[model samples]
Target chain A: MELFPEKYSQAIEKALERYYERYTAPENLYSPARYILSLGGKRIRPSLVLMAAESFGVPLEKATDAAIAIEVFHNFSLVHDDIMDRAPLRRGHETVHMKWNGNTAILSGDVMMIQAYELFESYPKDIFRDVVHTFNRVARLVCEGQQMDMDFEKEEYVPMEQYIRMIEMKTAVLLGGALAIGAIIGGASTTDVKKMYDFGRCIGLAYQLTDDYLDTFGCEKTFGKRIGGDILEAKKTFLYITAFDNTTDKGALRDAFSITDEEEKITAVRTLYRKAEADKAIEKSIAYYTDKALSCADSMPFPAHVRDTYRRLAVSLVERKV
Target chain B: MELFPEKYSQAIEKALERYYERYTAPENLYSPARYILSLGGKRIRPSLVLMAAESFGVPLEKATDAAIAIEVFHNFSLVHDDIMDRAPLRRGHETVHMKWNGNTAILSGDVMMIQAYELFESYPKDIFRDVVHTFNRVARLVCEGQQMDMDFEKEEYVPMEQYIRMIEMKTAVLLGGALAIGAIIGGASTTDVKKMYDFGRCIGLAYQLTDDYLDTFGCEKTFGKRIGGDILEAKKTFLYITAFDNTTDKGALRDAFSITDEEEKITAVRTLYRKAEADKAIEKSIAYYTDKALSCADSMPFPAHVRDTYRRLAVSLVERKV
Candidate 1:
């Protein structure tokens, strides 16, 4: 199981290099794309696709197209997201829009999207229809999720359930799509694909919950940014909502949310969060979904070693620091 | 042939209605889409698609999917183009970004693109691969054209040939794709499809050249906006470049381009353009391509009625009063 970690990681790195090369253009239109792709992240989506392919008894190289497609799609969303959020930095470097202009970023993002579709087109003709159909459905949901996120900005209230649905559409569905794509290409049955999708969705939810926790409590060395950015932006993350619902000292928490002073707001919100024990709730939720995700994986008909590797990766994703 | 115009227009109107109905949530998100789609442009690309389909003896409805796809893709470009150009109005009404925020405009444009692909996916499974492949290639070229357009804003010296290529990618290829899709789906031979694509490419170039001429000389009622906007913006339109290359009065032309005063720049540029007979040059260039486009369409094996209808439409487009 431990050896699988290094194996998939190396495979992802190599696949990304080839994928990036295939899409590069002679014009500088791809310069920003290259820059952003090279600004490294965890490559979690691609790794999952590769790992799922291996678990299905297909070699990692056989699943390279699906893995690359998912990665390109993920980065495409990130580029447009940075433009919409007015985010200047990504992975500690200038976002595509910040480095270039908005028009360049928008066009480059459009090209990246086309590139993603091109990668999907590389699959055999027998699977092409299903792959494209699935890709289109997932792409639409991602846009729907983005629309909901923007809608939340204007509304006064968003229920916990609605927020969860938004995350499912925006984040989890793509991860599930990644796994499902690998399974489909690896010749898995419809039942197995659905099971893999369920497994991936559960892990995706846990992954986001852990992200919320880390945003508040993680050390700078591990988390890569200052804690409480979501608080500063009034992001309506899980911790804030949980504290708002559970805390008895409502006055301070309410005041903290409205505070204009940054330091005062952070301190006040953190205090209320601590008193409500919101971190404990977040941790418990992460573990619950993580366990559910692993259970789904266990039910799959893979070899024991492959199943164990998938289970361990699920746990480590929720528990990892940097 | 005249009756065919009404038939195709109604078909396009219905398809656009169905296209707009696909978005169910967040009325605001769909509002801009509906607003843009309903603005009632000439439906030129879709008309080309239908005409090409009919020329090959395919029922117009069979080509409806490709027709709608091209129209959707065109509107997608317009929505984002409005944002990039910071234009306040489109089709004499508020643009998407003006009616909504830039984020809403951007996200809607993104969804519009996804819808374009989804519409493209409606083709038969046998033709699906070619449809996706061609559309993907055209999408990449459109992005390249947009990048070049932005690049032109910074560079003072743009060759005439480069400008032609830029517009070909940015504006013509989709029209080319429209005709190509129609022909392919209509069971036209590969040779016939190639000829139709050439027909579209040539006509699109002529159409743009005509637009350039009309911008400087056509009546406000006929042209739909202020005349000489390109001159005021110092845009490197065909007229400006041809005048720049041929005119003996360099100082006056340079002053016209460099002037900051709105009225002064407009008067100065128009004066030099008239003196150099740039209007005649523009007219000649437009006629040159229009003739080429008609010749290309004539050389195809389409029915005489189809050929004559297209020829009439092309001439009317360049010679219309309103």
Candidate 2:
């Protein structure tokens, strides 16, 4: 069975379509914004908002303004993030900063942020206040996460635990905030809001872990990017750090890190990961969190069918090749 | 007498103090933010919000939230603007981007934007929608203006009209939005909201023109920076464009424009401007708008004392030498 309610899925598609319309004017202003927003990825964050609202028996339309708010904010972060990463492409298309200049990207990103808050104005008064407050907290944490990520680049050693916290702050808190705010808007109980937050946070963690695992082991075609892009960049992924900490064959790992040759370094690191079973270890960890996230979703007091749908969705997230 | 009610001024000061405190925690996260915000140039934008709110009979405490919102947003723009301008310092202090890295400035500026919206959560529900709508509109315009300014740098012929529009969009719109929103929150009529917007917009235009005049004519010590800095940069200020439009001394003006030596360019531009009487012409235009702005304020159905204070303020804005 599908993991999300059909109504929730349908609502998200409609909201995204309407949300896309707001950027039609000032073509130069909105073009980059639309490009980044319509980059053909699954709108998972908005989906979580819709699902949480639907689980509380509220109609999806009522929750949509908040959902769009979250989505716009997410895309805003991506535009700026792409600029910082100097990544030329996102989702198989040139990034906003790359397609246009960095100034355009920065300005467009600013408009996207303003647009996000504008979307929030459609919510009921009390709910709007709560949403804005929640959003502010999440937005700050996102910046903090980015700051930590940047700081890590300069540091010689970053603990695995610190890296996880950084990801949680940078990536997961917004997801959790989206769900919690959705539940609040749907008039869910305080306990239900808290529970949905936990559920979303766990899923976000699991999803990121799955991404780290796939970076090393997934098929290049299925991943839609290079198989070892993260390793090549020497990104502090779980596989590399785990292998560094626990590998019996330390020589190859150290040699791989020290290698100045690009292709040789990736090969050397992958060889060390395979020898150390780091990829398998990460796969096990991904499964552990996936199960944990599913359990969190199941613990919520919702109809069995609805609960099962969420479980199925969680499983699909972990299982997807990309 | 001061234009603002005493209570309004005190309230703005207190609220800004609190707003500064919000940046106190996560010392690392806020140091750069506070450093820029506390640099202590005139807090004119926020002060305008407060004064406008009081003019409409709103309690200063209630207006403080919106006032701080505009200030935070303005500072955010300044932080990013400094980076784009390649400006090393602002208000006699090292800029955030210069003190930290560009990434830190970008990230901190992002947080400041969030904080701007967060401050708005303090307003009552009755005006919440209006506040959000106005804030979003102004935020978008600010970005649009920045883009236009960037576009101007590349374009060879930015017409005088286009330059004015750029300033209107980039600078005037925020002032209009600030006062207009303050009026709305202060429970003013729709007509008054519009009138206040016009009042602020006219003042903003006159303000920029006066700024241009002062940069060339004012005493070096009192100008707060080097005299003729804009002329040195070959900025398309009103004097330069007007001189280009009217003067038969194209050779001298072109020489002024073409000179690579900074000191030589400043002398040449000033000599040509004097020869064409362009400085006097620009001063007349400044006076024209200052009068126009005063007329707008005079026509408002405010108390006599308030109107008089506005008239004096308008005259002082244009007439004062840095």
Candidate 3:
């Protein structure tokens, strides 16, 4: 109760190490899985699983397997997505597909997925189907979301609503699913389970919006990444989508984006973004989703302090300068 | 009983049609899954599921979901495997990867794997874990097997035993798993389940051998293929591995395989194969595995006539001329 998700994060890390430590023979397949998991990131989704479980009074032991499953599944998606995106680094390390060849990455990623399912077998018998069905639904949507994103990439423009659905599926469902699975394992009532999912869905959307925001506005000191790189690539992120919606002059956006000079392009796009009110609109949207996420906690059956942690988590995630 | 696998196959085909007919939006993703399924595979694995369930008096209604799951999962692997091998066709139709594109195939194949799990959720609550667990172990091994196959392709030569194990993992495990799942659903005893798996393992080995044998020797009218394609590619099949093992001069085998002329290469390799007793060894090996497979049925808890059908199935599978 005192440390909330931070306390749960340590437990999840321990469980993940234990789950993957038993890696056996077939060095080719198991090594890539272990290697990818070893490249650490913020264990946010699994922490959500554990925090939700704890809030409902479920023991950490009961939630451990689901936490590990979410982490491993997330890594699995990263392995494949990195290949599709053709990115070279993840977590400041070589991505699985890049370290290994595409074939090895493909096969290892496939095995990691089954390994994710195998984790569910450790759950209590009564709730096994609930946990598995939730995972299946979420996993399927995640794939669909990825397909949508890839599909949209080739198109000149994507509708704002379609873009929202894309991120929700590709990025958000796993977050919501992790929460729902944790709550289910904690034996929460159906009402609370749905509420947690809605809460998670909003938080996930806000987190993605903030990520899109940070790509443009984040300091190199925090992210060590060049701002407006997405603009340079003509990525149709929230800002770009919102900018198109707000502005009548589409030619300016094209002109602003066509600048080859990095600093100039970023400055020009930012000016255009401000004129379209896209900057303010994106800020408002992040708040909107964050508030929607926090409001779900008000009706939650859990105590006020317990719900406050969720609000803190959402706010901290979406409003971060980083 | 008289209809045997053919009877079960009709039911499997019906279930598959119904399952896939629900295809909706996101044509990019679902179409490839449905397209591959529509390519009209023999439905052997699903039929095996239904037959195994029937042998233990498990009704078809109880088995259809698992049957469909196995078919979808098998197709999923085929889609991915084709991409890995860069094969252009499946069952004389454009492979999913070739028909659409690699990214679509990867994503669709991923969704198909999840769909396989989703189908398992439709199983009766009591047997869900058993069915799902069997599918996971088999699916994981299949990936491992595929990895081994790709790895072996890189090496100059592979040992006979390793080749056998690779196919057993890559090819046999799914058949074994499908049968095992059907038995579990039928409430068969643990001994009977193991027996079915063993029977399937042996049959899968023999079937693969028959495929290898036909690839080099069968009539094109029957095979609808170019004979000696494996020889041209120098694939590490059982025959090629055995040829390498039985020959004294590695140089001669290499020379025989290096011939660019199709007839010359096939004849040179066939002659070398005969001199090294590889042809005899392969025939003996196929019989050995087939007999080994049939022996598992000798002490089956089911009736003698029921056991006779399994023997007939194995014999027809291995002994087929076309």
**Per-model CA lDDT versus the true structure:** 0.82, 0.81, 0.86
DockQ of each: 0.62, 0.56, 0.79
lDDT at B51, model 2 = 79
CAPRI category for model 1: medium
Model 3: how far residue A286 lies from native, Å: 1.2
Provide chain B's TM-score, model 3. Answer: 0.96
Model 2 agreement with the true structure over B1-322: per-residue lDDT tens digits: 4444566556767887888876664455678877887776666678788878888888777788899889889999998888778899899888987898777887788989988988887777767767877888888888888877877777655689988888888888898888888888888888888888888888888888888888887788877889889887777878888888888767878777789888778888888888888888887888777888888898877999888877877776676666
TM-score of each: 0.94, 0.90, 0.96
Predicted chain A of candidate 1: TM-score: 0.94
- Which tens-of-lDDT digit does each residue in A31-149 have in candidate 3? 99989887777788888889889889999878989989988899989988988888898888888878889888888889999989998888876678888988998999899899889
Candidate 3, lDDT over the whole model: 0.86
**Arranged by DockQ, best first:** 3, 1, 2
Best by TM-score: 3
Q: Candidate 3 falls in which docking quality class?
A: medium
The regions of model 2 sitting more than 4 angstroms off are A1-27, A54-65, A244-252, A271-281, B1-17, B24-28, B56-62, B247-252, B274-277, B299-302
Q: How do the residues A1-322 of candidate 1 rate in per-residue lDDT, one tens digit apiece?
A: 2424777778777877886676665356888777887886878888778877877778888888788788888888899899999998999889999888897787787788888888878777757777777778788788888888888877756788888888888888888888888888888888998988888888889988888888878877878898888889887777877887797777878788899988788878888887898888889889998999999989987888778877887898798765
Q: Give the per-residue lDDT of model 1 (tens digit) for B1-322.
A: 2324798999999888787787767666677888898998888889888988888888888888788888888898899888999999998999999988888888888878878788877777767777778788888888888888888878776888988898889887887888888888887887888888887887788778888887777788767899879888778888887888888778889888888888778878988888888888878877887898798878888678778877886677667654
